[model samples]
Target: MAEAPTDPSHPAAFWDARYAEPGYAYGEEPNAWLVRQSERLPTEGAALVPAAGEGRDAVWLAQRGLRVTAVDLSREGLAKTGRLAASRAVEVETVHADLQDWTWPVEGVDVVALSFVHASPLFRAEMHRRAAGALAPGGLLVIEGFHVGQLVYREVSGGPPRADMLFTADLLREDFAGLEVVELEEAETVLREGIYHDGPAHVVHGVFRKA
Candidate 1:
């Protein structure tokens, strides 16, 4: 994967260093599957993107007229987000905080986008549940991430080191219990994001709506 997260003791520092690199660590463009599901997003409303690394997705949402809040533990990542947002002439509220401790806006947002966020198994369910709780009635939560099957890709893959950090449709379905499942699938896709995430990837993609 991408350099096996250097400062594991302080994951934020690791991410900050990665984002502090010369160019967008994962590329300037939003994740391909996210763009594909954009039509399902609210036309005008609030969106919360946790672990929003470099703001590609947040910027895209803002461009489409959604008020977006992009949160991450890495200050450098959020700073890159600000730079990218400004470059695109869009406004994205950047929050620098660990998602675990941040006060999520409960039932206040219209959408939540989680793309390639590799949460450890211990935190994954809690994270997804909180994100789902933040959605308003009928609000949507769209996610795309590496599946456990991605382990086969090994060094060529771009996901969490531990298999538990990966995702499965069943896991997500159980985690988002109160939401109606609009879509869920595990599949293989060719990724073209940047140096960090470029290769064949096994992924889980899902779109769930709050009841």
Candidate 2:
């Protein structure tokens, strides 16, 4: 967990450089936790995925008959998402924009997937707020991110080094206040996604329904 640069020089540069290389930074498969929660998601509806790098989760949802729109800062990553979606014969609308400034559609989606987004504390709340507001009535919000306890794993965890960026069940509850929480918990799990994220990790998982 290295501290990200304080200067926000289009954070896209940081991610673009990483994604410009061959292979997905977080692997080509959908996150395991997200996969487990997918059973609860609507079979066919619009979904909004923020920080959807390489679009793995978005592609999976699209394949399941959901219309998915994946937003990310990195154009390179979104490009890979396009290729991946094409390979899977699914359609995933890709939007390359900074989450901090991106205008979310008003009650425009049926699901919001926050699979391992790990945004900084400065933007996390706003991001969650927008995600929540973007959801249509009764839409689902699925989240899975490194827990603050993951700090103990240090570099092995491969997430933001700043504790503020890591989450706790309480923090998520607050971030998504107003939503009806159906599931919220923290636990240790093995993550074998890609070269970027693979190890024993402490994480928080949540499922909130827009009231």
> How much does each candidate deviate from the true structure in C-alpha RMSD?
1.2, 1.8
Q: Write the per-residue lDDT of candidate 2 for residues 1-211, one digit (tens) a residue.
A: 2324333555788888878878887888998877888679888989999999999999999988999999998899999999999999999999988888898987989989998887777888988899999999999999999899988764665776778889999999999998999999999987887776778889999999998
Report the C-alpha lDDT of model 1 over 39-97, residue by residue, as the tens digit: 78777999999999999899988888999999999999899999999999999999999
**Which residues of candidate 1, in runs, are more than 4 Å off?**
none
Error of 1 at 209 (Å): 0.4
Task: Please report the TM-score between candidate 2 and the true structure.
Answer: 0.94
Consecutive 10-residue window with the lowest summed lDDT within model 1:
1-10
Off by over 4 Å in 2: 1-10
**Range of the 10 consecutive residues with the lowest summed lDDT in candidate 2:** 1-10
